[model samples]
Target chain A: MSATVHIADVVKHYGKVEAVKGASFDLAEGEMVALIGHNGAGKTTLMKMMLGLIRPSRGTIAVLGENPAAGEFSARRRLGYLPENVAFDAALTGRETQAFYSRLKREPVKDALALLDVVGLGHAVKRRVDTYSKGMRQRLGLAQALIGRPRVLLLDEPTTGLDPELRQTFYDVIQKLAAEGTTVLLSSHALTELEERAGRVIIMNRGLKVADGTLDELRRIARLPTRIRIKVADLPPSGSPAWLPTATPYRRINGHIVEIDAAPDEKLDLLRRATADGSAVQDLELIPPSLDELYAHFLRQAERPQ
Target chain B: MNALITIAAKEIQQAIRNRWVLAATLLLAGLALSLTFLGSAPTGTVGARALDVVIVSLSSLTIFLIPLIALLISHDAIVGDMERGTMLLLLSYPVARWQVLLGKFLGHLAVLAFATCLGYGAAAVALLITGSSFDGEGFAAFAAMIGSSVLLGAVFVAIGYLVSAVVRDRGTAAGLCIGLWLMLVLIYDMALLGLLVLDQGRNISGGVLSALLLLNPADAYRLFNLTGFANVSLFSGMAGLAASSTLSVQALLTALVLWTLVPLACATLAFSRREL
Candidate 1:
């Protein structure tokens, strides 16, 4: 896939503290990538460098095939960004704020105003922003970022104050945009929320890119144990089960529930063995490593010395 | 160019919504009208043209009042945006940083100009309607007074932008701006007064004194209005200085224009280097 954003060895230093330390990554065209990390892990700084709001101390970043730090607006007009703490003049009505951004973007004001309905802010468009709640303001921020049908979107903590229903609506819009070939970068701390939506995730810890891959790939790299559970209609009353595998150990979670721990390679064999006897096992459950687990594992691995 | 106008238009809209325009206009009109009537009272007893005498009084008032008003309106224009996080949003758009600074400066200058015209215009019209007779030269002096008053406001607005660009917070910008007003209008001349008294018209000759007066924008504005015209100068009690002063009207006008440009250029330069 062709890359839309190519970041090479970018580092940003503030006084003695380095916010981003030789970080490197690429975003493919029409890809939705999630940047997950804790607070102060350099997520916002990285996004700012991409937006050309701040210059990096070393290396380079390119957006839409143009150098972002060159202070040129030719590429920026096609890029959209929603800062973490979005702020607007409180006296301006929602519609007025939208109008101003549309003018800045040099697009038709009507087209920008139409985005208000898409973000579910059509009802409160006439009210001043100071009267809107945090969620409403977030939606307005989203509407502003959607101006001019931008080709690339950089959203920081996009779903911070959104309700679950609005969050779903928000992702639906993102999915539609991605379907139209808009490259999206979501920088957030919401791991679970992005696990299903984002095809690729980049986990950061203390300004270092600890892991960058799909969930399944990271889980495989982590090498954590997989869990398998079987519910039996009848519990074997004997001290040991004759049907149980000899090599793998089994523990009893309850009278009818038997749990088995399997390594990554041994997972298929354990599953085949448990399903071989249909009369013994009533229900089976297999739990793979979750993203939260993978995140913790990667953070730990990143801290270890070479 | 379009971006510049759009940003400036937003500032104008903000001023209207904030009631800054109305307040400025009302304040200037009240002060100018009071000065026109109350100041002209001495003219009836002294046998001088009422409007020309009012021009002399209002020129001195502009020296003290316009700079403070300009600073009060513009001191927070840049720093407040950075503090509020709006500057980031504005910069994210496809516009240059200098455009933002220039747009805000133009919008604020327009606001000040509007207030100066309407506020002092009401007094000028009231003087004419009250049957106060004045010739073409007297009216010309009144017009110059209004025009130079706006220029003085522009100078302070530009300085306020410099303070706003350099300071990190609105509180500090406001503090420095107030201190600037004090120094230029009150303290600078007070110190100059002591210097002139000590000089005894010997070491600091009239040429040196005129150049020193040009250092402060208020003094430049005073020389342009109060001393440029004969009738205004006689009534303004600056006849001695006007006769001996070598600084011409054109030079004082150029000084006011430079006062506006130098600070505005500094503000643009300072804001461009800023991280935000």
Candidate 2:
């Protein structure tokens, strides 16, 4: 598969401050990728550069195999975008906003109505945008981007301020689009939200791409330690000798419970040996390295000295 | 072409539905009607010529109402969107920046032209109902009045968009647009009068006057509409005093074109760089 988005040593600067410091990455066609980073980490800048809204200070960026700054309408025709803060003309009703965008994109008028239905704005179509709540307006924005059958969708914090149900609806729509061979590149400050939805993640910090891979791949790269909590009905004395030699850094939470971080391979063996002693074991809970922890680890590395 | 029409249609819908725009347009129309009636005072045959008086009132009133409407219509073209965060949505479509600018310009011009025609037409109908004699010259003058007002309105709309593009906030854009209008439409005329008074009999002929007229879009508009009428010599003499010859029609047209170009170009450049 061809790379839909290719950024080669892209450097973007705002005068004295560098928003992106020679960042480079690529996304293959039909992939759902997430860009997670802290505020001012150049995620917005990079996304804008891809959409031809901003020019890079240095380096090359190819979105759908074209230099974005050319402002080529052909390239834009193939892409759809939902900005972080989606706003509409207050005077226009939801139907009107959708219709205007559809007309501008040269799409079928019915597409606008269909998108409104999909985004759950069909009932509110006649209401002016000024009366729309934040979530309603966002849905309208999504409806517009869905017009013209675009091939690539660039969404910036697509679910900001959305309730949990609506957010899930957004993810379902994204998944449906991606399954239909549409490439999606989404950026959001909400890591957990993206973690559950994105097929792959790109972690950025200080305008640099620190990690980019599947969840398993990133977890291995970041080496974020695993956490497991064990609860025992009766406390084991120091002389009980139930613990394995590998559980060296294990700490007792209380008289009965203990918490420890161990390698994935060693975790089961450690647990088996601990329970083998049968010193009144109660229950155990294992927490793997989630995308949130991986994100924090990369962000911290980008901030600290290696 | 469809893109342009699409944008224009949206702009018209937006302007019509906006309470503030509707209010401003109505207010200007009301003022236009009031000014028309103000010129109905009974005077000598020359002054009592209601058509001439109406023409003068219109010429003067448009100096204020044209800019007021222009400012109201266009001072929010880009800045308002940026502030409200709607600009990004507009930009995300496959529409080009130039299309947005041109479509907005045409939309505003259409609305203003319609409003002006309504006001001017109402005044004309009122004059006819009042038994005012309709002379050929008076009719021609009235047409020129409407034409010049539309041109002047278009020029100021471009200026307002330019100011809106450069300023980030709506309030600042409004203030700056209004300030520039006052300086050009109000203060520039006064300043020209002061200059003429100071340089009386100094061979400040029409060339200088024409050059100054070219420099000020407001003055260019005044000269264009008010020339060949009752006080033609007052303006032509001013042109003569400031320069060797009277202002050329060609030169005036060029100046007006430049008036539309400079502000529009600035607006385009500013908008292209803006972080919408």
Best by lDDT: 1
Docking class of 1: high
**TM-score for each candidate, following the candidate numbering:** 0.96, 0.92
lDDT of 1: 0.89
- Comparing only chain B with the true structure, the TM-scores of all models are 0.97, 0.88
Could you say which candidate leads in TM-score? 1
Scoring each candidate complex against the real one, what DockQ results? Answer: 0.81, 0.73
lDDT of 1 by residue, A1-306 (tens): 788899989889888999988789999878999998889999999998998888889988999888876867888889988988899998889999999999998999999999999999999999999999989999999999999998999999999978999999899999899889999999887888998899889998888888998888888888988888888878876454556777667888777888877789988876777678667888989888778878888888988875
lDDT of 1 at B270: 93
Clash total of candidate 1? 0
Model 1 Cα lDDT, one tens digit per residue, B75-173: 988899999988988898988888998899888988989999999999999898988997999888988998999999999999999999999899999
